[model samples]
Target: MADDAARYLLGIDVGNTVIKAVLFDLEGRQVGSHAIDGQSTRPEPGHVERDLEELWRNASEAFRRCVADAGIEPGQIVAAGCAGHGNGLYLLDGDDRPLVGIQSLDTRAAALAEELAAEHGAALHAATLQEPWPSQTPVLLSWMRRHRPEVLEQAGTLVMCKDYITFKLTGRKVSDISDMSGAGLLRMPECGYDDELLALYGLQGLGHLLPDLIDPTDVAGTVTAEAAAATGLAEGMPVVGGLFDVIASALGSGVVEAGATSIIAGTWSVNQYVSSEPVIDRDLLMVSAFGPDRFMIMDNSATSASHLEWYVREFVERGGHHDDPFGFCHRRLAEVEPRLDDPYFHPFLYGSRLGAEHRAGFNGVAGWHGEGHLIRAVFEGVVFEHRRHVERLRAAGAVIDHATLSGGGARSEVWAQMLADCLGVPISVADGEETGALGAALSAGVGVGVFAGYEEAVSGMTRIRREFEPDPDMWAHYDHRYSTSRDLAEALQGFWSSQYRDARRENNGEEEAK
Candidate 1:
């Protein structure tokens, strides 16, 4: 037998809703995978946070289950990688112990986002190439400074979710470049934290919170004996710096070339294209894509499956015989489409590109419609939001001839076909659902010299399953609906603003009475 490649890789991805540990062979095929379903604690509306220790416990437990289920020994894993959701803030005390972890799905910093924009939006865009959002690390830190200065006074460092886990595993407090880039803290041209950008964001006073950045492919550290015992992994195994889930999904889906784009619809609508040069033309997020020359040009937000998940969980009672809730909702949704006068839903429950005043709602609902119509509206609404980003990318001269679809929203044939038709592009579904984990493993392969470099690793590991061609007839129909959706958003701009203003006034009155 020719030298049989027997080594395996372990990829750990800590997302907003789940902690996934997947094992992949050198060929990039998944040998086995396991997931732990956990949720962030919502103390109040829009304030999404997690208990730091609980998050780590879920990740470590998932590792044990993954190893046991995969029937792979800890020593068999040659190298490992850790992938996490980008942005948000995970702080460590002076003792390097985790404080509280705020996930990227949070909107607690909305007021701060407005404050930053009104004061320093242009400067921030010039530096980071994206506008401020509520979940970014800097905005979160600013909110803490204003509301709870005591925590900031006692804090030692701030890191992303995976950075904290990496620190726990290797006793090093380092973060991957992609995570830092998206945190609205780094200067794109310099690829490091900038004093000017910090000053503009009014965050220079707290620049000590930023963690050191390392390349995604760099070996962050060796798995220490303490971490190894906790997670059933071999001690001293190499742990590489992995990309953010957005970059990881692109890497995992094989969108490594400039023209190749990827749509990730997990908790967020990440519409990104791989580019050789970092362009700062308009308001788009750019992050390092594992290489110095390469960056992921992303128009993204918590505006994809998160919207659908929220709608079904709150309004629909879908359960019992179905495999999952979305499945049931989609099954009913597939029955209603291509018809005009359908309700238009704004996927702004989390936040909106239409400005801070925008909120989520369904328009054109009537007495004749049932639960099925609302379900279908939710699907189209989220897809419409994704199309909005795709349009922005297209306008920027980004070639999105064809794109790979990966995540929970892509699995639905109805929604997938709708996405293809609506975007007017051939959408291909990638082979693996755990693209983020696979991305991590491939980077580990690069770190350990299993592959010569990132390019070789990506080629050896990525595969496409099926492609859905856009239907000209369906595209014509969706074109009208898309225009209507845009018009609806524009029309409601005044109403959304007035609603927000009135609500704030009511709350102020209540506070005065107290």
Candidate 2:
């Protein structure tokens, strides 16, 4: 007879800050969870890389700890699944050894992104339904072709971060559809590699570098003896190819249904919506791979908790030491009245790639204004930025009646409520903090036939903890502020673009002289 816990599954999520591993039973209850801090190396400006060997070692430790905490033997686990950050590029040599794994935050490929978009023209847009971004694979590949040609020449395969780890574990070089779809190389909606697109980028025959496209619920491969020995997993345990981290978070938040939207509030806040087809708007929004047969259409702002952290570190440094900074910020924000008498703020402290250029400062910081007002301005600024994303989605014909909020920032009731008010929509906090891991597990469950379909797996595993409905009075105030924010953002876009171009030219001239 099979023991109840023997049918357990393991889920691993590789995030920017941490690699979290969770053990779940067949019924979807978390038996145990463990986390390991992930280290990132930035050798130069606009570059971020992770040591592959170090990542594997840390993941192994986390896996062993989670398994031990669950009180389950290695052989007892029936299956495993993995998820990780998306968009970055990973180069593997002929023998499938990782040479480099660049992170999405790295902006070294910006010029290449623009070059490819210009060269490919309509073909690129028709394929991906979105223009190449600095983080896209094609741009990264082009960067490599010019800067690191040797690596590209000797490369046998190219994989994303998650796919590389999956290959290391299962010895299978396959990419799940969701992750592949985000690669700029794959044709969106069709979900396959485009040869002409690759050729246009001077990457002809590079299609061979990509793995077979499998559905997120597909059984990618089984653990081998080497993987079992390294990670303490049972040999032959099935491994499911999970979706990209963003898509997994969406699934784990139970926002898989069409018309549903989710705000992933981590280091960056990504506003995602499920649509029956692709929603591609170059001016304001973008689209990404959501699931095996689904699409995600929305806007992604590269700032969220990172902005909050910056405020706490720079302005409220001492306040963070005495008590929880988030809690303190929340309480302080609550004390400040909603109407600050036409005081405006721009939340682009880091100078957004798509938004306003001003730093976090009040238009009117009079002696009468106190610390509470300053803190409230910060919170209101972030929320207002999110509201702009919501408005962009609405303009793209998306119906975002509600959104599930998931991330470190979502823990604050005050912030969540502020978002609810700013967006004029209900916001639900996700039930689990580890939605990425849960989504990976749910995908595995579907792959292994433990669940009948994606809907069933999601229904059994994901849940919403609480919902925050929009306050009509506060929404009215935010609606007016949002209009002002948009006007300010648009007015400053050209100025930012000119500055960026001038800086790039100066830097290029210096490099040539060197």
Please give the RMSD to the true structure for each candidate, in Å.
2.1, 2.9
Residue 449 lDDT, candidate 1, scale 0-100: 88
The 10-residue segment of model 2 with minimum total lDDT is: 350-359
Tens-digit lDDT string for candidate 2 (394-466): 8888788889998777777888898988887899998878888888888888888888987898887877899
Q: Mark the regions of model 1 whose C-alpha exceeds 4 Å error after superposition.
A: 1-4, 286-289, 317-323, 502-514
The residue-level lDDT of candidate 1 at 393 comes to: 85
Residue lDDT tens for model 1, 1-514: 1332568888888888788999998888788788988867887566788888887788889888888988877888989898899988888988888776888877767777888888888888888877777788888888787666788788999888888778877878888878888777778756788788888766667777777789988989998999988988889998888878888888888878776899998788889888887767655644454567878888887778878778767766445444577767867776765478878788887767656567889999988777788887878888888999888888888877888998877777777888999999899988888999999888888988888987898899999988999998888778898899999999998898898777556645753574
Q: How does each model score on TM-score? A: 0.95, 0.90
lDDT against the true structure, per candidate, is 0.82, 0.76
Q: Point to the candidate with the largest TM-score.
A: 1
Where's the lowest-lDDT run of ten residues in candidate 1?
314-323
